[model samples]
Target: MRIKTTRQQHILRIKTTLRWLLYYLLIFLSFIIMTSGTLYKPILLVPLAIAISINNNIYGSAVTGAFCGFLIDICCGKLFGYNAVILAFFCILTNLVFELYLKNRFINYLMITAVVSYIQCWLDYKFYYQIWDYENVGRIFVRVSLRVWAYTVISAFFMYLLVKLVNKLLMPKEHLTIEEAINTNIQNENKR
Candidate 1:
């Protein structure tokens, strides 16, 4: 009985690890696809990271957000850790908001995504273009920043669905039999 319990625990750990790895892989794949030299890159990482934050704990969401932001920095050729910090902060805040105030619904997530994406875009425009006093800053903001924000918000719908599907597929099913439940209870009592 002890050996069987240990084996089951090991298997559960492996499954949990695999699920996290799949999430990271999804982020990497999105990074590659979004940065592949299209006329209008959609800033796909923003929505995807937000979607991830919606489903994960605060620490996990922050780490995922930092990873996504690191990719964004690389894609944009900006200073390292800039987007990472911003994204991590936003991810934590989003997680807290969901935990406290908002329900985890599609429209709610989309609205949050829009706000976060717009803030990112506006900050990028302000620091990189406006502060630098670049010629035609308004034009650049309208053409690039606004478009990127719109595209990112549009992509949020798909990212949210993808995240929901992944979560459903990987989440552990809790259908223990009576005997299994008894064994689990015994194990817990033994630990105490």
Candidate 2:
């Protein structure tokens, strides 16, 4: 017998304008935290991506990506807007994969994030950066791409832990599951 899955209800909703301000604040804080410290030095982006992807909310995903990328830009003090553009792209890719293929499975999260993060780094090096010469390509690949895979793969578990931690700390008494959000909107509209 298939078990019935019920949607969780949210006390907070994007239903309000103030909620958007909350989103911005959360995004800004998350971005600062993700960018502030030097974790391992090689794999900063993956965990940040995971942090955003876990909630499976578009607002969270976009905000996390946008802020993380901006932080990188600010810290690296290099090409402006590069990280932002790439992260936004990752947001779209993650959303597409979630909607079409994965449906919020753990493996899907790992695979999507790993794939997107790797591609972003590779492109960042290849097109946006010519700092490295032809001979350095192999070295860069080993350092950046390979490291990213390792980072994402290893970071996946920690990401899970982080989600659980967030759930414990910041979780609401009632929060909207994807279904609840849709149904709530539908019902609210019918009343109007």
Kindly list the per-residue Cα lDDT of model 1 for residues 1-192, writing each as its tens digit.
Answer: 333455666776776687788888889889898779875878888888998898678999999999999999999887898999999999999999998999989999999999999999999999999998978889999998899889889998888888888888775544565578788899999999
Cα deviation of 45 in candidate 2 (Å)? 3.7
> Candidate 1 — which residues are off by over 4 angstroms?
1-8, 173-192
lDDT at 91, model 2:
77
Q: Report lDDT (Cα) of residue 8, candidate 1.
A: 69
RMSD of each: 5.0, 7.5
Model 2 segments more than 4 A misplaced: 1-40, 128-135, 168-192
The prediction achieving the highest TM-score against the true structure is 1
lDDT of 2 by residue, 114-185 (tens): 776677667767774556467657766676557755765676566556554555455545445566778878
Please list the C-alpha lDDT of all candidates, in the order they appear.
Answer: 0.87, 0.60
lDDT accuracy of residue 179 in candidate 2: 67
